[model samples]
Target: MKQSVTVEAGGARMPETTTPHHFVAGIGAGPANLSLAALAGRHLPERVVLFDRQSGPSWHSGMLGADARLQNSWIKDLVSLVDPCNRLSFLNYLVTTGRIFAFLNAQFTAVPRVEYARYLAWAAGELGTVHYGVDVVEVDFTDRFVVRGRNGAVATADHLVLGLGTRPRVPECFRSGTGLIEGAVLAEHLDAHLNRSEAPPAGQVIVVGGGQTGAEAVQCLIRRGYRDIRWLGRRHWFAPLDDSPPANDFYRPTYQKFFYQLPDEVRRSYLAEQAYTSDGISLDTLQEIYRANYEAFLRDGRAPVMLLPGRDVVRAGSTGGGLGLWCERGSGGRERHTAGLVVIATGREPAPMPLSAALHELVETDNAGEPLIEQDYSVRWKHSTAHKLFLQNRGRFTHGLADPNLSLLSVRSAMIVNSLADREAYTIRDEQVYTMWA
Candidate 1:
């Protein structure tokens, strides 16, 4: 069992026993909490800790394709947006690792996803507040919040921040057939599946989903020399991400503030209408796929990939020693395809909240049973005035498109830190907007 230290409070020595105490205890050491830990550690070193179930620092390690690149700019790192002077900035990482010159020489429009993952690991190592391999099971509130892991009570905190990121969303058609089918795999697990499979390079493969992940999966299959590949998507065309300046305005703090002031219905409707701003395939990646297809066609006189857009995979099953997929076409017809391997890259949903029954009862929820997140990302619960329970990446409905994107990571962290300390720890300034969102 872990032990605790005592300190003098109110002119008396308190007997602090085995469990550690902190001002804030965050669950999950993803970028969201890692950013918070980095900022909090500077001001309140050893006063904030993050618990993660993973054994080590990794961000979507399985999906780190050979050519996968970050959709956002490198400057939108963990600390630079709010506190560029902080020691854990991405620029500092490059300088410390002696890769600044080489990185600049490369002139990458978007840095590789693997490089960003390494930057996060480097920051996590510097902070040294993440407790890995500790699966925080339940969180209950009494005098303060008690965070219980598999071993027992890991720590207690005056406030809690849930950054339990997201999990890969499996379609209902593929859910039951996952283990029974030999070659079925989720996008996140494709790397592992490819490593161990004995399938031939000429095998037929199906890549489902229209977003970035789906495009990446198709590229991976083509690189692996898969001759017959079918790419299916629900959209009429494989739409490229709207990364123009005006589209990017939606990710700024000014637009976020304007969005938060709108009626709930309007905000929700806008999000539905503008999903492509954040969820579409990168233009570069789409171009690469097209160029690759054209080059291969010129050499072999046949294209390897068949782009089957406007089709939604509705049913899946096993057929003739392979996986069979049934898709509902946008033009009102049903189509079927059989492939030796099927990769599902649909999307992701927020991970389940790790609140105990009692604590969950105290927190107010919306009609969908999600916690009512406020403008500052704090949950509107019974004890919110006294003790806060903040959420990260769980406010797309409340905070707009910027909530899940990496563009405003530091800004969000600064907001949470200010809320926790009841004072401004980092100044958040957004000025001189060209567009009037009001």
Candidate 2:
């Protein structure tokens, strides 16, 4: 039997088409939602349904550089943290794909990003619950949740899950006529641009933003034979990531619970203090950049990359047929530079919720207008508790820093699954608590 989805418009409906009401309808088929689908099980057909705008399973494909790797371990995959025996474990993916021994022999400290992306795709394919090429535009509720996509097909569900990941943050200075400045591209697109043309001009290439993306951009430029590269950052210096044991204690489930119970003001302070754990550039990347610069300096007279920190990009304009950037120095001074091309690697923020106007009014929000997510990952709304809306990758303020990190995907999904099933579907055990966070 062919299934049909009714299209709903303003005031009137398209036609009479039968649509199956799902127990849970998910809005993005990324890792977060994929984790939930993996643990939700395969016994029930209509238990979960996911929609994504992508035509296929793809994750950060633009930024998958040759040497790029994952920050977190492979053990924190879709289902491992909670249910390793689940059909969609990363280990299972390797074994089923007949590469377990080869992968073990490689013995990577952290797996490659490309491999992780393939693992995610394998999990998505194995689950077979994702509806690709469907962009969910609006979501509201009446008797049940109504999800309307850009293609006009609609779905209904008793509960909803939103796993819309983050989008790159465009700097304020780059908002020109078309909201984009020529010769300025995001770090994500730089690789594609380099692939098309691997040559550099006479003018220097400037990379803005000081985090991992910025570092990666500098490294990419260096590898492509761009000799004159300048890196600018707001921080005092290019700091390496603090992957120490004490810093990692904050990522445990017990610590996550503790951080959630803290006051909002304290949470903000802690996030500021502990931002580097999740945001800083890896030591391996730093060493590579330094080593590459050394090798280049040994061969050529001039170094490849110039590290300039404590400078904030204040303005940008055209000068000498190239882009010129003005910056305010942190130590009470100013500087300017001209570049043939500029790469913006600032950071990423969560994608906006696609809730309809009616649905938006029912949900409670913090001062920043972000939806307030509960401990179980459910949003606080005016509707009955029976119909819930859960949000992922948008609760960094309420939850700990682990909210946005991929280290706790399965644990967070387990929390949501337990709420939906109205039972303890997965047990989250963090018994090895040696560090007492005061």
Candidate 3:
């Protein structure tokens, strides 16, 4: 029996009847969102929808260098921290692929980035309920979040997980044009560029940052055919081996207790101070590059890796023909370098979500005009809450330094799930949220 439904009833105008779809929808299929989906696949009997802008599973595919390795240990993969017993752990992936023996044979502490991505893809495939090529455009929170993708199709979820990843940070100097200077994340493309191209007449390629990306880019390019690559950094690139800080001490359970207890300002300060230690190139990677360059030097001709230590890139612009990068030296001097290509290996920042027009009134912003996220990483509502809106990768300042870093991603997922499971009783622990006193 088909009933015609097009009519104006009450104050609502009904055009046509639409089929109902039930789902707890997730936005973004990056590692963080995928981690949540994987857990849901294992635990949730109810329908769950996962959405990604990309066509399918890819973790930093743009920079998935064949030779690039992970900074964190294999145990620190997507799922192990939260659900070590989960079958989707990287160890499990290796075992399932029958590469456990081979991987162990390689005697590597951290798995290669490509291998990890493959593991993620395998997990995504088996998850079986993921939606590919669907970019969730808007989310409106009523009772649940009504998530709309690029198409007019909408999915309603009791909870929404926003794992929309970071955007590459392009500085103001590069506003003129990206072609003027090359800025790349995920180090491998630069490697390929250096591999295929000969050193320009300018001789040097300036890599601007001392972090992992910067160091890895310089190292990879120098390893390839590039003759001269200048690694510029605000701080001196120390021999990581000589300063091998214990990782456990920083991320230890005891430290986390103290860390969480500290005031937010102190926590921010602490994170700022440890940025180099946490995100810098590992001692091993740095040492390998240093050794390779040293060997090249010993061979008497091909040491092309030059470290512009203790300097910050102040300004960069096009020179007469090439590119001019001006820097401030830590030793109280300013210097400029002319390079054929200047690669900014700086990292990324979280991008904004397009909230639905219906729910704009409910959103509460922080003092800094950022969305107020709960400790469990849900956006707070002012009135008439319909559904839960969870943000996965979006809360950095609110959730502490662990938000974007892969440090506690899995545990965060688990906590999010637990919070969703017991939504009625959940309490947000973060200080960013406040009660609206009407």
Candidate 4:
């Protein structure tokens, strides 16, 4: 027997005719929830569904550079880490699409970002459970959780999973008098700007930030024949990612379990101390930038990029036809630089959760107003024992650096599915780890 309920729809109270009640409704069909949907299909077929605002499958499409490679290995795909034999594995995609031999012969140290994006789209197509073009605005709870979009009740579910993901964090300097600067843009939007019929003048261009995105933006400008480009970083010197053996240990399930048992203060301190393990730029990317600059200098008798580290842009303003930047140097001196265009790659912060106010009050929160997630990735709430609110990518402080990184996406999804089923859905095994941190 099925229970019917009325909900607000199109400014009028009506009944939901299209979407049926689901066992679990995942918000944001990004890699996190896509991974969950893949695993859940094996055990809870036709029971789970995901809603995404985008019209179709895409992962960081705006920033997908032509030569950009994934920071993590290809093996750390949606299902391979947990169930290698799963039909949705990256290897399966390669073999099924007839690119396995070409991919193997290419001898890529790291797979291209575009290929991974396509692989995700392929997996999403096979699952057939994701609802596109549905923007979930408010998630509230009644007898069961109601997921509402602009039109009204989209679906109801016994449990909810938030893989909301992150958004670009624009700094205060870029937000003052006007909404957005005229000649400045985010790194993600650089491609569109570069593609315009009227190419930007070969003048001074500034890239602000020290991470991978910033390096990519600088490289993009150089490739586009922007000769006089300035790359600024707050760090003393640009650093490469620490993908060493011991650092890799921090991403394993064994380390995540140990990290969860520690006190809150200890976890915060550890994250701060080891931030570089995941945040640093790739060594290969840095080398590419250097090589490009060297080759350009040999041909033109002048370098394309000017690396300026230990300089933080404190304020920005327009200088009529150009942009003015005031930077604080490491030597306690202030410097000013002018550029025809500025690209901001400052980084990203967590996207704001879309829980309704009434429902948010029922969920327990930390002093910082973040949901108190347990070791199993379920948020502690009044109705948690019955209706769970599972979070992914938003558990960095609770779970370790691996929470946000791609290294542990499958493991995290498996933990959530097991918790939802109240049984071990997938057996997680981490054996012979050498590092012991207590």
* TM-scores vs. true structure, each candidate: 0.95, 0.95, 0.83, 0.95
Ten residues in sequence with the least summed lDDT for candidate 1: 1-10
| Range of the 10 consecutive residues with the lowest summed lDDT in candidate 4 | 1-10
Off by over 4 Å in 2: 1-17, 42-45, 198-202
Q: Which stretches of candidate 3 lie over 4 Å from their true place?
A: 1-20, 42-47, 177-202, 238-261, 357-361, 383-386, 423-438
What C-alpha lDDT, on a 0 to 100 scale, does residue 101 get in candidate 1?
Answer: 99
lDDT of all predictions, in order shown? 0.86, 0.85, 0.66, 0.88
Question: Model 2, residue 277: what's the lDDT?
Answer: 94
- What tens-digit string does per-residue lDDT give for candidate 3 at 196-282? 665453466778777767777766676455767888777765424223444434543234445655666877787776665466677
Query: How many clashes in each structure?
Result: 0, 0, 4, 0
Q: What residue runs in model 4 are displaced by over 4 Å at the alpha carbon?
A: 1-19, 176-179
Give lDDT for model 4. Answer: 0.88
List model 4 lDDT by residue over 341-414, tens digit each: 89999999999998999999999999999999999999999999899999899889989999989999999999
Weakest 10 consecutive residues of candidate 3 by summed lDDT: 1-10
